[model samples]
Structures are given as structure tokens and as C-alpha cells.
Target: MQQTADRFPLSPRLFSFNYGRDSSAQTGCSVLDAAFKRYFSILFPEFTKDEFFDAWSEPKSFVVTVSVKSRGCDGYPDEDSDESYNLGVGDGQAVLRSVSVWGALRGLESLSQLVYQDDYGSYFINKTEIVDFPRFAYRGLLLDSSRHYLPLHAILKTLGAFHPFTHIYTQSDVKRVIEHARMRGIRVVPEFDSPGHTQSWGRGSVPSGTFGPLDPTVDSTYQFMERLLKEVKIVFPDSYLHLGGDEVSFSCWQSNPNVRKFMEKMGFGKDFTKLESFYMESIMNLTAALNRTSIVWQDVFDYHERPRSRYVVEVWKQGCYLCEMRRVTKAGLKVVLAAPFYLDLPIPTHSWARYYNVRPLAFLVLEIWKSEHYQTELSKMTKAGHRVLLSAPWYINHISYGQDWRNSYAVQPQNFSGTEEQKKLVIGGEVAMWGEYVDATNLTPRLWPRACAAAERLWSNEQLTLNADLAFPRLKEFRCELLRRGIQAEPLFVGHCKHEYDGL
Candidate 1:
């Protein structure tokens, strides 16, 4: 991003939007059209009826032109899709161009961020040129709907603020959530945690007499999983699915006579890990048959000797996270790191610096998660040739007084000890908001400005966004922008926005 000394005044009553030939053809696209209108309203929220009529009637007005190279848009964004964009704001007009519609959406977001209102109530923009792209392809947020049911409108508002991967519980409104996500160029990867979180599945999914984790020894278990996953594949068009293989309490399986009998017959005695392996492998094969990849918790790789390479491992345990990362990547499996960024654990105010200071690959040779031998670990993983997603920085559900967003903004995925090539393997990061204590009532205020910080870190260049101090005013303004858009974002400090929220 480059900025010059030049400034241009903008008038809400005399501003118009235009599209290039390719993008003009996309005007009929509901996603693009709706987004444009949404941003327009956000930019001019208080415009009167007369002002709107004057702006619509004006022939000579400042115009922003959007162009995309792709003729048609995809139903959903995928891993290989391009989200890079070039935005230029200068002269009499602004031009936004991208290779795909997804990039155009990002560019439009940047454009909206650039516009500001002055003390005199006049709109203005600085002369700026931004060539922006996500460092990682899969920047996302993970919301857990299992512990507590989140309302549909709250979920929609969340999607409006950030791209997310929803961990669906039994009560989620799946189809409506997916439809809303699709229109915003966001992919909804549904997580159906099984074999452990199956407490929710016991009512109708399993035999009435039995209730708990699916019995690995029974054919009925696999049958139920097949039917459930089949429906999931149809409902979620995304190519990836999260088959949670975490926190299995073996007591339930141990207590079952059938499971014990099957284990002994298979020459496996008291090895609960083996039972878990069997369950996960069957599910993975089922997912493959459905032509979708599976993502599981790190336990799948930790307990098994030869887990399949096609699946992704999410490392969320606190102790020895780097060791887990090395083990998973060395085995030629991709990983998503969720070890350090657990938002559910509350900390002191201004603790965001600790969150921000965590580099994905840096260590001090300590006994804890960060190790001094980071380079050696990174070199080995680079040879293995796989990318990793990070979920280590932003966990908004854990509340604190004062500005906690700075902590979220401080985390840099590539800030660790490694070569440029090794750093490139750090694909992207996600901010998780688990549902243990959070629900529809507090979801929006809890996630907004904090998650917004993570969003910028993932989307913008790290070098350009390293300074937290520089970002203060900008984020303060963005908080106001979100409020005007009806997000109900919490205040940053003991201050107020120029336009107060009316709680509509």
C-alpha cells in the first residue's frame, strides 16, 4: 500500500458507482449487487430522502469502477481461488480490479475502509494505491454452535463481519447459514464432531438403550455416520469437512461389553487408542467416498502410527504444540494450529500483546510450546511439502475490560524463526469463538472489533500492518463503521463515536 500527499473530497450526494465491461455483466449477480448496495448504505447511513434523490439524479459525479477478469463466479470460494486485488484511488475516480469476484469483494472492503468523515461532516479520501492479497488462502473464523444454540440472525451478522467455518451443533440452521455465506463469497465448512462429541447425537442417532460416543464395534454406528455425512455433503457444497476426532472419553467404550469383546477378538487388549483409530479411519474413508476431504483434531495423528495423509489435523492442545506440529507435518499431513489462540481462556486486560507476540515458528528452546530448535523443525517440515493454517491469535469469546482487540491484532503468523520459503508454508489463520459461554445475545459485541483486527492481519501485508500503534485510530473509526452498520460492537476505550448507535 502506497499513499501520496494528495487528498480528494467526496460527497455522498454526488457520488456514483460504475462497473467495467466484465464487471457490468456481473451486476445481475446477487452477491456483488447486494454488497455494493450494502456498502453504499454504510457509507451514507444518515442520508435524507432529498439527498438520495439528488445523488440518483446527478449525471456528473465521482465514480468508482470495478472490473473482474473472470466472466462467471463460483457458487463458493475454494482453496485454489484467487483473492488478490489491486485498488487505486486518485484523480477524479477510483478503479478496483481483481482476477476473481472474491478479490473484488475484498477490494470493495478496502475501498470502504478508505473513506472517512471529517469534523465538518465532509467525506474525504487520501490518494492511495493498494496491491493487496491474503498471505494464506484459508483465512477463516470458527464458531462453535454445539455448547449453546446461536440464533440465525446472530450467525448472519457474524458472516457479515468476517469469513468463518462453523462448527455446527444439533440445533444449527444449516441451509440458511450456507445460503448467506455463499452470497458473501464465504465458504461454510461444517464440523460434525463424532465418536466423542456424540452426546448430542445419542437421542435419535443411536439405539434408545445406548447413549454416548458411537460404538466402534457395531455396524450400526458406521451406518448412522454414513447417513448423517451423506446429508452433510449435500447440504454443504464446500470441499472440506471437519470430522472432529477429539477428547474421546474411553470410559464409555470400555464399559461396553460388545466393544471389549470385539477388541479382544481383534487381538487388541485395553488399547483404546486403537479403537479410536478404527473409528476415525472408517469415517475418513466415508468422507473420501463422498469426494470431500476431512479435517480432524490432532489426536487422530498423535495416537495413530499411520493415519492417512489426505486429511488435515487441527492442533489445539496447549502443551508441546510445536512438537505436535512437527509430528503432523513430518508425516506429510497438513495442519491447522489452534493451540495458542484459545479465546475461551480469559486473561488480564492488554494481554493482547502476548497473543500478538506469538510467531508460528519462533521459540526459545524452552520446555513449553515454543522451542529454540524452530529452524530445524521448519526445515524438516518444508521438505515434507505441506501448508498449514493458524488459529492461534484471535479468540473473541473470552471477554476482558479495556481494549483487547490489540492483542488479536498483534499476532503475526510468519513472525517466527524461519526462511522466507518456510514462512510461505504458514498459509492462513482463524479466530475461534467457542459457544461454551457465548450465545446469540452477546455474540456480535464480543466478536466484532476484535475479529476485525484478525481480519486485517490475515488480509493485509504483514510488513505494512506490524505497527499496532498506527492502527489505533483506523480501528476506532472502523468500530464506528460497524456500529453504523448495526453490528453493536463494544467500545474500545473511554470514548465515543461521532455518530452514536441508536440501538435500532
Candidate 2:
């Protein structure tokens, strides 16, 4: 049988040529059993719920066996850890096994994606044996809820479509997003930006004629953050929490009387960046005490007296990516690359290709190649043995009205040049859909299909990316599959393909 599995984000780690007719036998996973039923029922609504259930409840159905290595596998699945699984399909039976139920959950989703209907409407699965694990532990998408509050339903939809995504602000919304994401093996890391990006937080709290940054000098500021984080920590159980530490305009800190006094008392002496560092360190310490690891933007590492390895720094500085990366990694800090992956920036066409070509470690290597002097120091600093997460082909914000912009579906995240050792430093990448102009209603279409490109890049083999001729067609089919499954992913270019394997 010609393999349809090749069309997925990350094709199964292994598979054979054998194939079997797809059966509605009860899936091993109860969660996915319901999901499959809902999926097919929506597509083939002519069948009643009983009819659908009967089809799934038949003998020799899919077998889901989870081998839990730890406690609490049944509750909310944690995305901060491993999500690997082994799947075997052949010999008249399909077996899915994982160390944790979380892996089983991901396996079920992969199985569902593998099933495609023929023109005659029969579903089939390719026989395969596979072991799969994410390259980077942190494959994520960041939605800026602080910029535009995504409706609760929209956030849930995005979570459903994008398995692991975060960056949230609204208290009530974060609770709901976390609950839904947990069910789907997605971790919702709530980012209530502190000391900066607090325009919205400052609306009702601060007095007139003042800027939005939280006042580090005031004891009340710490109290407010303590209360907020206490509430947040309870709602979000993910180990990594993002406390945005980017872009705190010093004028605001300088102007505040209490802040100035506090800085002077601490002997900071006219350096607001020091005050920024103090604020971040305080919050990091707080979250650490609360049993949560803090993730801050790269700026915090620069201002602080000494970098702490405990915090995960997301490097997003424009024009200083390599410099910042080297600094953070040399400090022994784990880093995620958000600079090259900003999806909000507008690139003319083939945007996915642009994202795919970026390599996290190549920057320093190229610099070293260009200059003979810094090779030794650059090598040591660049390869700090840290895993990197990428965010690319950011959201375009506006829908493409008529044209399916070329290259939207060409995302290949592994496009980079480096020695094998240096390249191995990459773990995975994320597709960011910042909510500056997005909401629950429109965010799905904006993210889908295009984000699928990043998904495939992060999951699939790099060899597949080399041949766009093959990757493009597979990606088109993947997008349609997502749409058929009720995800609102937009088309690659212009008109939609009507069938599951159209234009292939």
C-alpha cells in the first residue's frame, strides 16, 4: 500500500508496508475513544451515536496499554516531561504502549491522524512499529493574552489544535485554558509579565500620570504579585512559569519616587537595569519557593549581577540573538530561541522556509568561522550543552483574502548548517501566534495549517525537509486532515482541496 503516514507532522519513527482496513473497534484510550467518535460522527452524522459506538465496540479493536512509571498518570497530563510512545500495527491487531498515559494520549492522536477515508469512504491504517520522542522537551506556541485577551473558548480551541502552547494573562481564562490543555497533554504556562508589559495590569491599580510597569520600590507591588502568583500557582501546575522580564522602560522606574528611594537605599546608583534585575530575582526566588521554575525573557540575564541556571531564559532580542544566546548558555542557563521564531513579523512569501532555515547554534559557529581569534571561546560558549526551542512563521495577524501565500506551508524548522555535534544542540521549535490582533474566533484559522508546518519540522526527519516537492504535497494533505478533524486551519494558497488526499 502507498503510505499515507508520510503526510503527518512527524511521521511515525518507524513503519512497514503492511496495511489493514480501519475498524471502529473501541480505541484503547477512553479519551481518544470519545474523540474518535466525536470526530467521525461529525464527519458522518448520518450514523446515530449508538451506531457509532457499536462500530467502535467491536472485537479486535485498537489496544491502548499504558505502563505508568510514576503516580498521577490519570489526571491532568503534564507537558513539561517526556511524551514518547511505541506503536505497533500489524498481525490483525494494533498496539499502543507508553511509559505514561500521556504518551498513550499522544499515540492516540497520531493514530487518528493516520486514518484516512478512501473515495469509497473506508478508513485504513498502515502497519507500522514506531518509537517516538520530541527532539526538544519544550515544543511550544506562545499566545500573548496580555496583548489581546483570547476568549476562553478560543484559547481551548487553540490548545486542542496546538498541543503545547502558552503565554496567558487573564486569571479566569488561564484557569480554563489550563484545565482544557491538561486534558489534551498540553501544558499552559501562564505568563503574567511582571515589572514590565503591565499596561493592562496597571489600569486600575496605579494612580494617574504614571506608567504601566509594576513599581519594584513599593512593598505593595510585592504584595500584589505575591497574591497574584499564589493564585496562579494553584491554577497552573506546570513546573515552568513565564514571568516576562522584557522591556521595562527605565523612565517609569526613575520617575516613581518610591522606586528611586528604594534604588538609592539599595545603592543601585542611577542604574535602573539593576533595579530590574532585583525585581526579577525576587520573583524568581518566590516562584522557586513555590516549587515552580521561572522562565524569563533574555533581558533579565543581562541586567542581573549573576545569571541563575534555575531559570529558563527565552532569548528574543532583535539583532543580538547570537550575543545573547552565548551569554545565557555560558552562564549555564537553559535557553529557548524566540528571536528567529517570531511569527508576528511579516515576510513576503514562503514564510515557512524562512523559519525552517534558522539554526540556533550556527550563529556563533559562523561568527567563529569569520573571525579566527574567538574560535576557542566561541566554541565553548556556543555549545553550552543546552536544548533550544524555536518559534517561527509567527502569526500574520491578517487573513490572506484571496491568495494562498506561497511558502506558508513550507515550514521546515531544522534548516541550518553546522557540524553534527553543534546541530544536536537543537531540541525543537514552536510556532508563535501572538494575540496582538487575534482572538478566539479568528485565532484558529490564523494558526492552523501554517503552524502545522512548524509542527512537522519539529517532529519529522530533516531529510524530508530537503525535498519541498514531496513536503509541500504532504503538508497540503495534513492541513486538510486537520480541517476534517474540525480544526479551523486555513488553506495554503487560494482555494481549498475538497478531499482528504486532494492535490497529492
Candidate 3:
């Protein structure tokens, strides 16, 4: 059977739930499940509710065996396992396994393609036999509650909305997303972006007017984070909790002398990085005490900010220099490289070539060969080992460009500036929707086709060509499927249409 799918142009299109009482969680992610079932029912009359929850099917049905292993299996499980395949669907000769939420999302996309075959033209999961599994065992997403607060209702809404996917934001959303993600053998990694990002709820202000002040050293801040993180662990049972350690201007400390005084009393000298280390160490200790590891931004390592090895660095800087990537890996810690994966950049001129070219490590392909230097320091880190993460921002804040992020977001990965090897380095891609401008009307349309493109890159992701302009027909079919499923996608871009868009 043909494994590599016919590479279609990225037709990005990509969920939600509940009744009056909110039945979206355990019971089919009630809201989104209802929508999914209803939508699929319209398409396939035989798709019943029981079949959706059957959990286990046979090789004939194309079993998706998902296994959880401790160390790297070179992206495969035990040798005795069922047939093996990448995220792209092939024959039942092997199943695709991935622990990443992004991985599971990819799996879902593959299964979705199989289930919704007619929608995508002459496509079908012809014949296959296999089981799928994940290597590292923890695939996740981190939401910065510190920057902007997400209320309880929104948290539940996220559970419902992302029901079909492996992503859930808050600790509160874990138990819920887990019920589904875990059923598919995917892990739910929740993040608490504290310290600097927490101004939205605690310190109350940031900069002069952006939000307000955020005293990273505030005792109350620690108390709140401690309780929240602990509560989250309980909800998740067994999952990593992300402690966001990024983008703090340090003005919060400069403004508050008490924060400085607190640091000084702790025996840490008056160094900023040192203080940041202390702050992170404290949170790290708290999480460790609960037997949970933390996900922190890599900048914390900029000046010897030693956060225990339990804390993983999620690199987010713009450049993809080899020296920089090696530095974090050499520190004897796990790494998830997200720097070259910024999909939110509104500027298309940065070019995919630029993104694809950033290897941040040596011995890469010519496509990634650039004038940028690759140092031994990073090579050593590469030898020590690391985990690469790809993050695509679905961040549509209020100020985010209207309707434009669509053109750029979906194909960012394919449009990348590097070699094929570098592209494969991406374990998976995330549709990070930063809740800013998304209120109601445009959120659905703004995110659908674009996020689906991200999914396409991760799933059935062979021979990718981010020809957004060329994807209209396939996108229209995908959009029609989503519409059949109840998601409100943007109108098909039939230019010279019989109507006009609002003169915005």
C-alpha cells in the first residue's frame, strides 16, 4: 500500500461542546463531541457514538497502538511491537505512535483523513496493520496565565473546544483533556507561566500601562503558584507542569524595593540573573516536591541560572544558531527547540528559507547551511542529547492582524528557510492560540484553516509544499468537512464574489 500521501497544498482547516449543564468532558467532551458526532453523522451515517469510544480496534480496522517509554527509542517503540510508521498513515503493516499532544493531533488528523476520506477526493488509508506509540512520553502545551488570566469557564471551554486535540491550558483543563488524550495514549502537559508573566492576576500591572506590576519575588505570588501547580498535578495525576520563565522586563523588581530586599535576605547577592535563578529554583523545588518536573524557558540559562535538571528549557529566541542550541543541551538538561518555529511573525519576508536554514546544531544539511557559526560548545550539548519542539502561534490577540495571520500561519513550516533534515527535526507543531483578540465572531474562522495547516505539517506530513494559494480546492473540501462538522470556517475565497467584505 502507498504510505506517503499525495502531497496536497496545505489546505489549513481544522472543534467543541456541551449542553446547558456542560456535558463536554467525560461524556464525549459533551459540547465538541456533540458537534463532532453530529457533523460526522451527517457525513457517515454508520459512525455511531459507541464506535467513537470503542478505544481498541483490530489490525483490520488499523489499530493505533500507543506506547509510553522512558528514554528515546529513536522515535520508535520496542522491537517486538506491531508494525511501525511515522505520523503519515500507510497500510496496517505498522501503526504510528507519538506521545506529543502535537503527535496525537497528527494521529487524529490521519484518522480523520481515513474517516473523512471522501471529503479529500480519492484519498483513503487503503490497507494497513500496526500499532503506534510515543518515545519521550510527554507531549504538551504551556499557557501563560501570568501574562493574562484565564477564568474557570474559559478553562472548561478549552477542554470542550480542544476535545478532539491533545491540548489543554490550565490545571483545571487537565483532568478533562486527559480523559480523552490519555485514552488515545497521549499525555497532557499543563504550564503555569509565573513570576514575570503573572502581573495580570497578582502584581496587577506591567510596564507603564500594558497591564501592571509583577513582583516576581512576592511571597503571595509563590503561595498562589505553589497551590495552583499542586492542584494541577492532582488533576493531571501524572503529567509535567510547565512553569513559564520568559519575557519579564525586570521592571517589576526595579519598582519594588521589597522584592530586592527579599532576595538579599535569601543569601543571593544583588545580581538579577541570580535572583531570577533563586525565584525559578523556588518554584522548581515546589513542583519537584510534588514529584512533578517543570518546563521553563531557556533564557533562564542565559547567565548561569541553574534551575535543577528537572526543569526543561523551551527555547524561544528568534535565531537558530548551533552554538545557542548546544549551550542548553550541554547543561545536562532536556531541551525542546522552539526558536525557529515562530509562526506568528506577520512578516512573510523573513522567508521559509531563513527558517529552514537555522540548524542551531552542526552536521546539518546544506539547506540549513548558513553563514551562522556552529560552535563546539553546542555540539557537545547535541552529543549529550536534547528534545526539539516546534511551536506555531495561534496567538490571535485583539491587536493581532485581522485575516492576515491566515495567509502566513498555515504554511509557516513548509515555507521554512532550511533543509529537509532540519524540517524533520521538528517533533511536532503546536497551534498556540494566545487568548487576546479572540472573543467570539472571528475566532473560529481565524483559527480553522490556519491551524489545520499546522496539523497537516505534523500529520500525513511528507513532501510538504506550503502553496497556500494552490490549496484552495483542497481547502474548500476540508472547509466543507469542518462545516459538515459544525466549525465555522471563513468563506471560500472566491474573489470577485457577488458580495463585499465589511470595509474594514
lDDT, candidate 3, 128-158, per-residue tens: 3323443322223333333234443443333
lDDT of 1 at 436: 88
- Tell me how candidate 2 scores on lDDT: 0.55
For every model shown, what is its TM-score relative to the native structure? 0.88, 0.77, 0.58
Each model's lDDT comes to 0.69, 0.55, 0.43
Best by TM-score: 1
Tens digits of per-residue lDDT for model 1, 353-438: 54444444454343333332222222234325444444534556776766677777766555443345645655566678888888
Off by over 4 Å in 3: 1-112, 115-187, 203-224, 261-269, 321-326, 330-332, 340-345, 349-429, 459-480, 490-504
What ranking emerges by TM-score with the best candidate at the front? 1, 2, 3
Worst 10 residues of 1 by lDDT: 371-380
Clashes of each: 5, 11, 48
lDDT of 2 by residue, 134-241 (tens): 655666788766556565567666672222244334456556666666667777777778787787765645466766677787787788788888887887777778
lDDT of 3: 0.43
Off by over 4 Å in 1: 22-25, 51-60, 160-173, 204-207, 319-323, 364-387, 392-394, 414-425
